[model samples]
Target: MDKLKLYTNQNFDQLRQRQDPLADQAVEDLIANPSFIDVINSWDIIPDQLSPDFSPRVRNFLQFYFDKQSLQETSVLQNGQDFFAKNGDIYLGLLGFYSLPYCYAFGDGAEVLVRSKRIVQDIGKRLAETGVFVMDIFRPNAFISDSRAYLTCAKVRLIHAFSRYFIQKYARDWDPKFGKAINQEDMLGTNLAFSMIVLRGMIKMGRNISESDFEVVLQYWKWIGELIGVDTSFWPENSKEAFELDRLIRKRHLKSTEAGKTLIGALGGYYKGNIPDALIRQQVDGLFYFFLGKEASNALGIKSTNALSGNLVDLVFRFSGWKNYGSKKSYEGFRRMMEIQQKEQFGEVIKLNLPQVIRS
Candidate 1:
């Protein structure tokens, strides 16, 4: 607890006030590019274009964001990536049930998501897009010089920059007390939601991820943090530190708020419609309680349910080993689910547009 206090007392206020200057610069450069209008008009990633056409100047300017020139991969990172591929289904499940809801528990961070109207209005599509981003990055040999993952990270970073820019400029209701939109602390917390929280969920489900594996997963996301402009200078080094970090953040920000409730309500509605089976839906709620625990579930207004539902959810996901499921099959199934989500939201698979295009 003493060490935990030290971490919690660190000037997170400074982190909250900061935004990603590199990604913000990239967005500024992009908007100023000679082909800005032409590119925005034509570049819709309907088929998921990994590489988009940019003028030489714009491309050169954006290269630092995508290239990850400083990242050095090792056997541990490769193994971590391999672990994610082998358990793609479980990874996605943890994301939806545990990670996203856990994020919503943070009052201020959830407020930013609430202001992002697209997230509340069409959450299914957002979920699909989020899944696609994760799959792209975690795929074997991802983040290479020409890999789609690099571009995907770059795109997301730009999206964050867009949200920060727009909200600060247009959101009259945004309080200064809420800190900067998409700030550094929030970004790091989100990264933990994907990496450490996912590992914690795996442990809850009876999987025994070794300490080395856990540490490598943290390292893998550190590389991601670098690319996405999250300052990871204080990122946790092991499971113990990770837990402390998560607990510290939760202590500071986990509370009931309209923003958190709205996001979870939308999530529940989307899953309820798609799940179809009453029992599975109950299990979904159980899984929420199971992973998020009492404080977070209550923060999101998740209803209390019998313990059986959570245990059953555990039984459904728990398996003997990491590689029990084939990555290809899991990827295809997940992609199909996302396509259905997109088709439902729009008339067809929706094209990815710049935030400017999206807003316009």
Candidate 2:
């Protein structure tokens, strides 16, 4: 066996022991890349199933996210071109939905993150040596991280999309000065349906606001999911809270889920940028439905192994928050963390506007 393939396979074994879907997805991913597989398939797959019991629907969705997306302009990451692809940002953004849930259920996401980082590093190392562009590194970690970043960027992008789509649909007069009507379909991608599902999860947790506010994004997501034949209720729908509370959290992002008065606290933060007394629960109620037996799960093409992939993210909402003055003051905190991430990767941040017109 080639040393590199051996190294990667060993890493995958440890990942399998942890029972991670993203890691499982990574192998199939590496194998899918013509070049990467060309070299590794000769090495023989040990256990065969990298992630046993992966859902066909989700596996297709995740693999499709990697295969189809890339970064869009206004991306905070300077190196955006190096990371994202068509709908890449949304794909990565959905991955972030799992962070709070995973952290609560899995304890520390560092192992997963490290494994992810390793995938990125290995892919980078491989590409760097050959100077070959294998369509977004073709590595498992890159798949997860890119997918995560895609999710985060999706939230921001969808917010931008919401701003645009909402204006076009309802308030055409309220312009943010970007330009004339944008092709919402062109801007957000078919994946926006799934992205809407994510925003829905964020909103459902608190039940603090109207689904109408973000339903445009959801509509777009539905279009995309349907294009690929996925169920519309990809997110938790039945146990959702009221709209008013959901709105409170979306505008203002509370740091922790296990706090009190989350809506009140989120409101203050939305209006003002201050952390209120909305006590962030030290422990997020991660698996209310997540940790529950399989019977309790909504199971949108998920399994015990693949559960890490957005299958349980709505649980982030289950963590209660206190709506203290301080908490409301510090809502919509997604900005700061994102800014920090850009700043940290400032050196590697690469920016370029891809021509929307792909030449034949």
Candidate 3:
């Protein structure tokens, strides 16, 4: 930790010159965009179905960003199917991966943003094979690997690392875009990412049921509980998407059927890193994608997961609000987020630090 601080001091410009010159340019270039500035200087995002909607400050922030007509015109329901990525809720939600650290790094302290941008640039290089936005690598269509074994291992490792950070850090927000929040597309996007991580890894591994694979798979579930503030069991019993995910996970992991009871950890215990078994089993919406992907894959006779992942964009793009719907409201803590928005909206002396509120 101390080493990181020393390396990324206020004089980061000077620091980067000494260590990496190319990365310095990339970060410098990305930070210079007009939208980037607006995102950084903004506050809250409005709720879709939740009550007490956007604060005046957040409304003003949107005014600078997406005017009412602009945002509305791109609605998934109204726009037919082309509303997911190019111009709608999914795009807005994904903006966190695209715009954060660059934007909300200014959330708590200015240094968080600086260090975050540095982290993104650095990680971007180390995992250039993976992707800055993780879905590309972990999905079915990353690289055509030299060996099938390497692809399997890479997918597993990538998914494990992603879920670990996602549950532990990504959901943690100094602001909406900065941290991982359940508010992300009303759980649609979150479920999709989680389920896909497991399925992609499993498929890459040739649907193997090895112990290590089980461990990582379980870790996926434990992490899911860490980030999702709900009864994880709602998946297998309640939602069809959840049921399909469980079915695939079970079929792939059939060997350990008896000991699977231990795999179910209390949400709090799972979050604390206690392992009864690897808890990566909450398949979220894995079934939908899996069925859709398999049907497509079989039709194409494609063996590589990366190929399927690649086609996901082309396939899902036809639906505008695939990642949308709405969400329930949370009881904001004592500080009152509404008050902060009001103060900032009217140009009152204030600074918005979402970390002070947004618990998980």
Candidate 4:
């Protein structure tokens, strides 16, 4: 793939406007691209038996989500893109450590993460690299064009599908009480965690995201959810609806599971040596506490950091304001932290890998 061609954003509006099969064209272009093909083929191919066809109900669910109105050029898009540009690093942290763990709190989902077992050895580096990919795709150009974003979305959907297959084939005797891995509810919960939970975390961290910016961010993630196979009817049209749906999902599915507790411990252990200095580490811990809050922390059994250190971190954000928090210096510091983790853990810049089925 020509790197330059990959850099340009697609004219999403024009494609939507056309009466032709623009969605099909988009998918074809995505898969045909050399870079995307490489990413997909690199994943471990599971036997076809494990990869069953989508049930009719699942097919209808997808159709309902995909048949939504086209995204148009508006101030919302501008504000949404601007929000990312200004606070990309903050959002990165929220997505990486804060919001992502909720997936593990779901018993079946936790089983998938723990059973995969790849995350334990290099959790910090893996998470940081994932964060890097997310930040890259969340950029204004990438978000609108749906180029890199589409690729990332596809990877996420495939991982869920692969995990579902793995669980059904290998863990049939697994306790039915935990529910099915990557079932519709679990899938939607994960999607909500990525979008609504991340947005809420950002606000809790003291970033003053305007209402318009908030809506646009939701819109951006909604599109991502669609690309990643979330049902359209499940997509929230606004933050209020998102929060309601998230609450309902959590009330129904979120619980303390052994797998979740273990994953949390592994994550904390990974961060211990990677954060550079005591102060930074303390700040991170505090931010985690603030974002996760008492209810969630207790649910995951996440230990509290030093109270003073956590408060200090919160104060820094409270006083810094959004612009300063997302300043060039701040972004540089964020990038440097990730780079150091990559070098220390991998001995080089680490490339993102598609999540593969765990054979063992």
Candidate 5:
């Protein structure tokens, strides 16, 4: 199959350097349009339907979590930084190869993603940008104040517009079950995967996150969701609500599909090619199985367990947890390590920018 040539040839940096006023205007118009709101409202079940009241536990947790002095401090920021530092690769793999492919398996989106051929590269670029966004959002004075945040929002709008285009261009090919490529439910599900699913993955890997830090991380994504035009009405206020919503969304949308399996195979193949060491590759395979569990891994055609390597990975995580617990210096070291890794992976932390056109 010929690869789709849907995106402009210009790179994102070039696109930003030569900003087109018309493109900018189109994005602003899309964000302001009421059609998005109508689509969100059309959902059969909203967040409120799942959890109407913010439970006392959640309320109290937030009250203390967001106390003025706490916000003034950098402990929460450090914790957020430390999380990625310790589990950056694992988090990226889970989202890109595991959670995302699982989501893509739904309807024609899988067809779209798998057929693109550039999907793996696109995922890599997005993951790199996401790490930048995470660091910026959690930095003391940079949350919502930084240019990276603004650019991230712009990129999101462009992606969302591209989804709208796909839905219109291929209306006949669309599946009612999935609604559209970037439908409200799917958008919310993506957000949940980044926060709730990520948290779950961390725990599975034996990382310990404090309650306060966890809430703050969710809050950060909630703000990002709002900025990117995700309906505020469906945003979960706390982890408990997020978990419930995650479960409900998965139950409604997740099913094995051939397109999904193909996409997963493409992603796995990409990783296998890049990772030369057989032992490390085997451990990564185990990690995928561990992260997604038996059912999801099987659906994606990921191989069964490498029990020894998997257990070894778990043991390493446990040891790291034991050594790093409550140690600020340890977290600081991890943060620096993560920064170095990002620089190596992406080559000098390129600024986030809006794409001139959709590439995938």
Candidate 6:
């Protein structure tokens, strides 16, 4: 694993400097043809339906990006999809309790999130949109040619570019040392948060996933990483690599910052009252502490919860998770809950913040 260190510093530095050129180019095209922005904002059309009035580069990029010809329906991928289908409720819980909170521990990337008021101010909607994206990719046959999943990925990638555009143009306080807003390294880190970190959380909760299953989950997100413009060449291929990548990233960037605290606090505020038990609800910080571990929780300034509350929260999660592991009813319940949350957060339909144009 020491060999991993040899390439990490140089490669991660390069990745930190890189942004999604394709998506950024599309943003530039939009700026050059402002009318095209109106067309994309319409929220009901696909790339194929765009008229010649749109910039050729933008149209071509949209078609190429949304096309799913590059995705392979291998046995490993299908296994990954099935795994998600069986355990999606647990997966969603880990995303909320572990992966996203893990993300806020990174100081530099948290700065970008802090600058994006929509994410901090509207944490519930952001989480719902993220859940939608994850479900879209996890769905069976989602990677089939020209599927809605690709459109979702394309929309998110472009949204990143738009955030970059707006942040670079505005946000006068943005420091260069953080790299470009939503740089490749940060995106890759976020990808790992959703994939490797979620799996790790499952392990922490006494869930047993085979090594093969774990690798496939990572591979599944590698494919997703490619679709979302993350550099998959740097993506981990196995447990050892994934662990080392997380270690390296944590060593380099897992420090406290106001931005990190702000993001995590905002998230915590949004999840208030989500717990059923009144006593447990009072110790919600215990849930954060349980999944994120002491270091990350401390970094995010999560208040200490009593030992009794911490163990109780862990038991509750483990018990519920065990009961619901592969139940379709549980999956549907989670989906229904998410739909209600989305409706409450973003009108009757979950219209994502940027580039609403996707084929209905």
Worst lDDT run of 10 residues, candidate 5, spans 1-10
Per-residue alpha-carbon lDDT of model 5 for 1-360, expressed as tens digits? 111221122321122222223223444443445343333323322222222243443233223312322233344445555555565545544565456655654533465455444465565555556655555454434432233334345455455555455454655755544444555555666677777777776666566756765677676676666555565455666666666666665555466777778777666665665543454454555666777777777766777546534456656544443443423334345445546655776676445543343324
Ranking by TM-score: 6, 1, 4, 5, 2, 3
Q: Highest lDDT: which candidate?
A: 6
Displacement of the residue 336 alpha carbon in candidate 3, Å: 41
Given candidate 1, what's the lDDT at residue 278? Answer: 53
Q: Give per-residue CA lDDT, model 1, range 258-342, as digits (tens).
A: 9999999898788877753455565667778888888788888887556644345666664312233333445445556556656
Model 2 Cα lDDT, one tens digit per residue, 90-183? 2333333332222222212112222222223332222122111112232223323344333222222222332333344555433333222222
Report the number of clashing residue pairs per model. 0, 64, 19, 2, 0, 0
lDDT of 3 by residue, 121-163 (tens): 3332222222222322122211222112122322233233333
The residue-level lDDT of candidate 2 at 89 comes to 26
Q: State every prediction's TM-score relative to the real structure.
A: 0.84, 0.25, 0.21, 0.70, 0.64, 0.88
Candidate 4's residue-wise lDDT over 180-203, tens digit each? 555545556677787778778766
Off by over 4 Å in 5: 1-25, 28-98, 105-112, 115-117, 120-123, 144-147, 170-172, 209-213, 276-279, 308-311, 315-351, 357-360
Ten-residue segment with the worst summed lDDT in candidate 4? 11-20
TM-score computed on alpha carbons, candidate 4: 0.70
Q: Relative to the unseen true structure, what is the C-alpha lDDT of residue 179 in candidate 1, on a scale of 0 to 100?
A: 90
Question: In model 4, what lDDT does residue 73 have?
Answer: 45
**What local distance difference test score does each model get?**
0.74, 0.29, 0.28, 0.57, 0.52, 0.77
Residue pairs clashing, model 6: none
Off by over 4 Å in 1: 1-6, 29-61, 276-278, 309-311, 318-353, 358-360
